[model samples]
Every structure is written in structure tokens, then in C-alpha cells.
Target: MTIISTEPQLMPFFSDAFLEKTARKCGFMERLRNIGPQSLVLSLIAALSKGNCTSIADLHRQFNGMCLSEKHTVAYKPFHNQLRKSAFADFMKTRVTFAMVQLIENVLPPLPKKFEQFDDILLQDGSSFNVHPDLAGFFPVASAH
Candidate 1:
């Protein structure tokens, strides 16, 4: 069982530049320049990494521990409003992908000490359903070959 740390220490791989690069790749910061100077995306992710932010208030508390500058201070309501924006959702999806890739790269499951042999058996409920040829495109199956 792997015990992941709940500490809010910023990892080197998930640095500001790394996240900024991802944000840029995902077009989270594509257009106009009149927005706030703070990197809310980084703040949000860092806060979430700490395992403390379950609600708006908790997020606000996490901001301080995330090492955000005083100038980057953002209230819960405004942050929540930004989160509700569609653009933020896209950014989050990209972040999720990055995290998944990192996990896959870093985590290796332990090998069994001794291989166990077991009989192969297949069991299924006695039921079948018909599929229309026209619907094959929507429900494609693997080729038997």
C-alpha cells in the first residue's frame, strides 16, 4: 500500500513554469491581458494537492500554505466564480492528464513473492441481446481474429 503524503510542499515537477506551460498548451491563457496578475490555476492546484481544500473556506485557508504571494491573494467567492467558468474546466482536465501521467511513471506495483496457479473459469448470466447492423458503428466489438 502506497502512502501518499498530504503535505503541501510544492514538487519540482509541478513547478510554476510546468503548470504555466500546460495552461498555455490548453489555451487557458489565450487572449486578453486585462485579467488579474495572480496565477489562480497554480494556486488552485497547489491548494488541492494539500488535501485540505474541500470547500471555499478550506480553499481560502490553503492559499496561504501554498506559498502564494500577498498580491496573489484571492477571496473564496471570486475564486469559486472563476472555477465555475468553462475555461477553468478545460485547464483542470489538462492538469488531470498531467497528474495521471506522472502517477503512471512514478508508481510501480510490487511483484508477488510467489506466483500462484489457478484454474481458469468463465461464468456469465444466461442472457443475450440483439444488435441492429446499423448500430454497429455505435457499439463496435473487437475482431475475433
Candidate 2:
């Protein structure tokens, strides 16, 4: 598995200018404020990269901690309000699409001849193991022991 660092490496994919433009396009940035698109996106990326973020409250704290300055810190209510908006979903979808496109274009190689017939290839792990008796109805085993 490849691990992407959250610092200078992520900057290429989410530059300040790109974040600003996309936020405006997605209606995520209705007005300039302490929690700008760049800061929010960078904070989210950093927090997620660390693998400790479990909830929106965690993200809110991460955002304040990573802000450019003290003046940029935002209260949890305002931060949660921003996230509850529909624009937030659109913004995240747009960013994920952009990142996927960038990964395919720059990092991934072209498909081989054997797979030319397929437009896309999705890989899934098929390994399975026994589960607790309580979950047997939910996740049936391949064969009884």
C-alpha cells in the first residue's frame, strides 16, 4: 500500500489557488472568513492522514490547530454549521474527483492489452475467515468446521 504524506506532497494536489477556485465553484465559499477553503481542506487532509480523526468534533479541533494564525481559529458551532451545509458535500465530491483524476493521469499507468476490453478495473479482496457465532447469520461461513 502507498502512504501519502500530508505536508508538501499534498500541496501539489490541493494548492491554495485550486482550493479557492473550486470552493467558489462548488458554493462552499459564499464569503471570505476565518475558515477559508484552503485552510479547511489542508486541515482535513492533515487530520485524516494521521489516522486519528474519528468525528466532526475531532476535525473541528484539527482545523483550529492547523490554522494559519490565531485569528483564523473558528468556534465549533460555526465549524459544524459549515459542514452541515449541502455545499460541503459538493465541495468534498469535487475534490475527491479531482484527486482521482490526478492520480489516474499522473500516478497510474495505462491498462495492459489483456484488460483493453474493460473500461475500468476494480480489485477486491476475496479472502474470508470464520466469524463469531452471533455474526453467523449476517456473515455466513463458506463451510462448517
TM-score of every model? 0.48, 0.66
Question: What overall lDDT goes with each candidate model?
Answer: 0.57, 0.80
Q: Which candidate has the top score in lDDT?
A: 2
Residue clash pairs of candidate 2: none
Candidate 2 lands at a TM-score of: 0.66
- What are the root-mean-square deviations of the candidates from the true structure over C-alphas? 10.2, 8.1
Give lDDT tens digits, candidate 2, residues 86-113.
Answer: 9999998989887776555656687788
Question: lDDT tens digits, residues 51-116, model 1?
Answer: 867787776656544544666555667656665777667877877675666666545664455533
Those runs of model 1 whose alpha carbons end farther than 4 Å from true positions after fitting are 1-13, 31-52, 64-69, 106-145
